[model samples]
Target: MKRFFIGLTIVIILGLFVGTGYFLYQKSEEPPIIYETDTPFKTDIIKKTIATGSIVPRKEVALKSQVSGVVEKLYLEEGAQVKIGDLVAKIKIIPNVVALNNAQAQLQTAKINFDNSEKELKRQKELFDEKVISEFDYNQFLLDFNLRKQEVEAAENNLELIKEGSSQKTGNVSNLVRSTVNGMILDIPVKEGTFIIESNTFNEGTSIASVADMSEMIFEGKVDESEVGKINVGMDLSLSVGAIEGVIFNAKLEFISPKGESDEGAIKFDIKAAVDLKEEYFLRAGYSATADIILQKASDVLAIKESNLIFEGDDIFVEVRTGEQQFERRQVKTGLSDGINIQIAEGLTEEEVIKKL
Candidate 1:
């Protein structure tokens, strides 16, 4: 019994030694992951959103003809600078045959009556002066002669208007269409022989030309409904044109549409920005541009890489390096964030080291 007990004890002791050796060997084979700390640097960070849009002129004017006629001449072409009262085009008369013939017949009848009445009036006046005619007869003859003369004049004026565009008294209405304002001719829609209709009270007729004051330019863009409420008139804006890259122009918010429209489930508000163009930069009408309105700015602030920030519920935390092998999660207060970088309002200073990745 003593020999059996001693043998069992030896076997148990050897099994324990082998188990301990296997545990130590497994731990040594595992790989280790290490992280490094970075020295904090001073930098400026701003949060902004990007929007895409096009540039448009501050004002646009469309010129239209005033009478229905064939175009006789077009003095100004596209991109022509013109002043007020400059003649743009002329219209040649295309008479109505039936109306012209009627006017001519009326004129001949009026002339016959006017001549005969004048002769009778002269004889009657002489007889009255010689005491051989009554005063009533002379007055009647004088009235009849004046009526005939008026009819003759009316017919003659009508005939001249049908043959030409206007009589001597009604000067030429077809010879000129003077510009109403000073501007550059942006477009000329009519050729020399193109027919045009007058813009009247009932309808918007054909457009003859388009003129605009190019000196005044504006930026038209849209902002998401979420950001629209934050903007107001007179706010400064930074703009970049798609065609003119690497340059940014400054502007001010001039208009905000009170209404909003839904686009692809997102509500958007239209905004107009008035560009303050320098004498060197002449902004052409309808150039595409992107505008950035600064909502907030800080003169001097301590900021950090945006990726370093972590959130738990509503609170923000950052991993602060404590020692070569130790780190702790720290709570921090934050201010303005410009998307790429964020301002560290509390729990950080310029000399503190941080982990970037």
Candidate 2:
């Protein structure tokens, strides 16, 4: 019985050593790696750069008051359609005290001069009728009297303009703000009783309203300096508005700034594109949008996923599958890349399999 127990213990020890050896051996041996493979396919690859901006009216006009005054009435509101010469707002003239006083004094002086001239002319005419004065001397007095009368009329008109912003002879009120262009009212910046300054040589003045031609719209955006060099006038752009979903508008590049401006520590160039507005969609001013500017494109060409490419110093290569589980490095020339798929310009074929890196 002692020998039997000893034999059983020996068998158990030998079994334990065998199990440990097998586990260590399995851990040391790694599974073979199988690389994924792909083939070049025909696709349209477009190389583009993105720009963030908004849609705005190409021709925007700020309707400003011609005379300084308080806004008495608003004839139009935001989004109202207007034509040229349409009354936008009525301003009540707030006449300057000093200017009013001067105008009044001038009118009084002109009236006194006219009255004196009238008496002299009457006397001269009576003498001429009696043949006491020559015709030429009487004519001089008559001319002076007419000139004085003209001065009085001028002074009266001036006083009326200061007091009421209009006169009978002119028939036009300067205090009436009118739309100079035919378009929609984008905004009415002033309300009733709001005092505004007149647009003049000294000041740009306050804008009473802003009007714009909604039919003609432009995409105003900025692009990074690195991408601006690749773009030019007449290039096509695809605009995607943030507010509108699943709609893309087409536009053409029209203007590119010759100089760059700094924005948030990055140099950016301003770009303007004329939008081809659709009849169904009414694009409001200042609709935030993104533009995809196409720099280059390849249609129905052999393309490979950009991730499969391997880059080295001044050269690019791809892993071409020579046989089963076998790949060899081959240099390839690339064309347009849309940041996902790249055009295989050379050294690649649609039938050839390539390892995906």
Off by over 4 Å in 1: 1-30, 36-52, 96-163, 262-266
Colliding residue pairs in candidate 2 = none
Cα-based TM-score, every candidate = 0.80, 0.92
Best by lDDT: 2
Candidate 2 lDDT, 1-357, residue by residue in tens: 999999999999999999999999999999999999999999988889999999999999999988998999998889999999999999999899999999999999999999999999999999999999999999999999999999999999999999899999988799999999999999987899999999999999999999999999999999999999999999999999998899999999999999999999999999999999989999999999999998887899999999999999989999999988999999999988888999999999999999988
Best by TM-score: 2
Error of 2 at 336 (Å): 2.9
lDDT of 1 by residue, 1-357 (tens): 999999999999998899889989988896865776655456655455455577666767887766667888888788888898888887765666798789889999999999999999999999999989889988999999999999998899988876666778767664367677888888788888887776899979878888888888888888899898888899888899888878898888999899998988998888888788878776777788988888887646888877888889999988888887567888899888887778888988778777766
Superposing all C-alpha atoms, what RMSD in Å does each candidate have to the true structure?
6.6, 2.1
Q: Residue 120: error of model 1 in Å?
A: 5.7
